[model samples]
Target chain A: MSQYSEDSGYVVAVDVGGTSMKGGVVTRSGEVVATDRRPTGAEGGPENVVAAIRSFVGDLAARGSSLLGRAPAAVGIAVPGLVDDATATALYAANLGWRDVPATGLVPLDVPVLLGHDVRTGGLAESVLGAGRELTDFLFLPIGTGIAGAMIIKGGPYGGTSGWAGEIGHIPVFPEGERCACGQTGCLETYASAAAVARRYSARAASPATAERVAALTAAGDPVAVKVWDDAVEALSLALATYTLLLDPSAIVLGGGLAEAGPLLSDPLAARLGERLTFRSAPPLRKAALGVSAGMLGAALLGWRAAGVPDARASWALDVPKTSAVP
Target chain B: MSQYSEDSGYVVAVDVGGTSMKGGVVTRSGEVVATDRRPTGAEGGPENVVAAIRSFVGDLAARGSSLLGRAPAAVGIAVPGLVDDATATALYAANLGWRDVPATGLVPLDVPVLLGHDVRTGGLAESVLGAGRELTDFLFLPIGTGIAGAMIIKGGPYGGTSGWAGEIGHIPVFPEGERCACGQTGCLETYASAAAVARRYSARAASPATAERVAALTAAGDPVAVKVWDDAVEALSLALATYTLLLDPSAIVLGGGLAEAGPLLSDPLAARLGERLTFRSAPPLRKAALGVSAGMLGAALLGWRAAGVPDARASWALDVPKTSAVP
Candidate 1:
């Protein structure tokens, strides 16, 4: 823990979700200190979301200054959408109902503020500090409310030619299978996301129970739960197999909510990927280590870099706020 | 012709096919001169192939020296195999039965000799000079005896993370389709390649005279030929659509023998791709302008670049060898 305070420059990392906004004072080594959260206020409009973020940042800064006696060097924010990192613009966010949100300018920080897609930022975190630390090439699949991914190539994330490189979720996995929110039919996300798993369980058993209970019942040999789990595993495996063939990543880092299922997901997914791969070496499937904090940690790293810190290694020098008393 | 001579230096480009070896003295501007050809003598082994290539080069050098009043600056060879341009090693050549053939060392020329894959070399020519010249991001899909492609990204070719990036033919188009020579089943090459089309026509029609006649009959509305043609187009379209979704190239340049079908191929492919692509912009389907000489032109450009020539711009130089001279 003493290693956490070696460098004392503040960087604000914010995770903007559909329902909530999470902000934190992240150390250079990816440790989060003085964290705060608030409702996204997205239903109220873009201005409300911006206000919430501003307040969150203000609160975080005040806490940091009171504790550490200095202001943050930069801020990094991660949001769910088609982010044009080159232009510092959120091109579109279907879930948040925001279009062309100039997030970089909206953040009330004199310091440099960097913006990136939520999944990509999570992938960056994985690449720098988690299972993908040593991998020069890998794919980060965040299986949450919606399945989307980011392609990590030679230690850098590929945003595609149009900042839409890792839209693998929208790729047609089962043609003519199911309608997706992206207006596509049979997308990989429709079958493999956590939402998909819960939907599958509900549709099969007509159960009103939470997905957590479904996981429990499936563990105890509930037939409908078992079927849903199996289908989710199969769908995930198919998508993974396709990714393996395309990018041939060193590994597939599974993150987000559904990955919490652990062996229930990894075991069957590994087996299915093995069955499909013939000519090439099948990549090892691993669970993401960072959990929910990945986005924050990644955003912090991005913020540090944006502040001219250079690389992920430099992120370790971030200043931690020294509070008079532990919060 | 005078401008071609002034713009390009004397360089020799060789296209090493399974059955034949074609060599030509190409100017820096992509014009061919003192062109020569000889049988590959593949059965005589790597040693014999080297001897044959040397003899061909010797003949071409003598003619080019006399014609241009100097020996060519460098030589570029395009072969059918996995070529490592960095190491100047041909990793594998199934048709030539050569593994790790160091053709660069084998060449007796004092000038630099650069080696590259035929399809990739062809793609380079197309991207720099042909239909894809204006597009920074595109895919060059050449469907000859076999189907393969080269991805052009940001004005450069991506040799995959493992230098095997352009094996688009091996990508499974139909999971339950026919077995391919590469040990995969239902590859696009099995149905879409020129050889596949000819084989399908020969097998089904039984009374086929030649591939040309079959093509003519197909154009004349023969039922058997039409079926084979339609299936070939469908397979090619599916492959193209998959590529469009994956890379989202600006254009899909159709080369090789089947591309000779012109509108017969492009119109249907465009329609299929348009139907498949929902959110993304549909890339234009166009014919490769360089034709057979595309390989030679690419080889020459590679040689020029390898030789450290200051102003290597072979693609833009209008020195195309007439089609009638080769095909």
Candidate 2:
């Protein structure tokens, strides 16, 4: 263990998803230890979801301490929707059916708490430890079950004055097309999200195949799947192109489940973005590196930072204790 | 005169435009007391334009000393295009026909010089003293012969990392629409600029008339006039709606010649924007109060701040020595 290690010191990180609650202990160097997952129990109300999170955190802490000999010193949690970082409040989360959730107070641990929006926290991870680490200005856009993004300006995440700055998914892409779950018509998420891709392919193909099968068909030159895939790429390109003109980022990092397609996504997106931009430099398109662990790593970083750990080195040092209390 | 105003002293403020150069002495209280104008003479080349500005400043200083009763302490210049405010460098301005214009040495002023983009400086004036003074996070969009905007974030203008933050007019509105002078297709300016309104009305009207005449006829419910007017409103609304989702600004201040249409522009724009935004709050739309002098006022404010003029007092008191020498 390094000089900064404390026997009772740990950093807890949680990612609150629409369907599940995933969390773990993270050492200062961006490593996840003793991670655990459970259904969000969202339909059981916010209290039940909190109870699940508490249980998850308790189990992770027990396992992490037994393995590494430490108790957490601080905690960080991320959720979807409008967040009030200044107040540590979850102002709203449409998917989780939460409003003004005082996340900082909900954690039973007597430690410093940090709260952030999920996509932004994911972006924080990318900006600090992923593909965007070298770029001062970049947009971290994750196209997954639903589409969302975070803007990094001058190496810092920019939450608009209202904390809704990176809601690019809500922007109308098709003008008057299909209605979105958000009650809007033709939002980018309705067309470009992973779920949207599957739904669109299923509707068009009428063969009722899984998204993976659709991707396979698209690769094999199936016309219906090709058309659906092309439309998704086109929509994503337009959205990204619009963002390039507006923000002029140095690069764009594509993450989330759908990004697993790798070059299948990056190649077409780069071409479309390049074609749209004339006078401005077309930012490079890259895939996110941290993968599914990005959110927890980011949340842990947030926790360490909130506890006044200045840099990644300090966090890493705090991860492993020099001595074990049980021994 | 104010305390800082001394006879033979002067402050230079330059307004760099697409086709011409306008500049003058700006009083400490945001007033332009003496002014000069000349063709930017870009046809002679970028070097010639710089030489013209140098001569213009020298001539203005030589002639306006008696009128001003003091030498200027600082200079503030507003230019068109991307400007890196941190380094005081004009990164790129297509209209000015210059790239990376080093403003510090270009102006050739002895006093402290403050440089800012023309539209952003105008936005500063609007935010401090014009239509948007009461609101935070407002957009100042000026639609004249061309279109551009300045975003006021958290009560200060956001000069994007490269100083190209507020290019709202360049965002693509129609993917397959007309080509823009900027070599892009379907830019908002191609459809909504004052020049665009005149051109569209001329091409589509049965008996073509001046934009003023078209405006009058549109007021009287002529079908062609109404169509042209509605199309412009549609483009502007779409652009503003996209901006609303991105920035969530509190209000939008409309300036420049097109704003003179008053209710003809605002009423339809409000209705269209409202129809488009379902989840987000629709920012209030209003006309700019500074009108033709917004840039000048902004320039003056920049001069005042650069000269170390405090804002607590409304006016400055200057002592001028008696002098009889005349040029």
- Against the native complex, each candidate's DockQ, computed on alpha carbons, is 0.31, 0.51
True contacts kept of each: 0.07, 0.45
Ten contiguous residues minimizing lDDT sum, candidate 2 chain A: A318-327
TM-score of each model's chain B: 0.91, 0.87
Interface RMSD of 1: 2.7
Give the lDDT of residue B106 in candidate 2.
Answer: 66
Please give, for residues B1-327, the per-residue lDDT of candidate 1 as tens digits: 233355456777788888897778876655666677789899998768777877787777787787777777888888887787778888887778778877666476788888888887888878776778778778888888888787786686666555556666766566566888777666778888888888889899876444556577888999998888887776666566556655657778888888888887778778876776677767788888888877777777877876687357734444453431453
- Write the residue-wise lDDT of candidate 2 on A180-254 in tens digits: 888877788888888888898888777687666767788899999888888888778877877777767778899
Listed in order, each prediction's TM-score against the native is 0.87, 0.89
Provide the lowest-lDDT 10-residue window in model 2 chain B.
Answer: B318-327
TM-score of 1: 0.87
Count of clashing residue pairs in every prediction: 7, 17
Where does candidate 1 clash, by residue pair? Answer: A8-A319, A9-A319, A28-A315, A28-A316, A28-A318, B8-B28, B9-B28
Tens-digit lDDT string for candidate 2 (B106-159): 666577777788998989878877788767688999999888888887777777
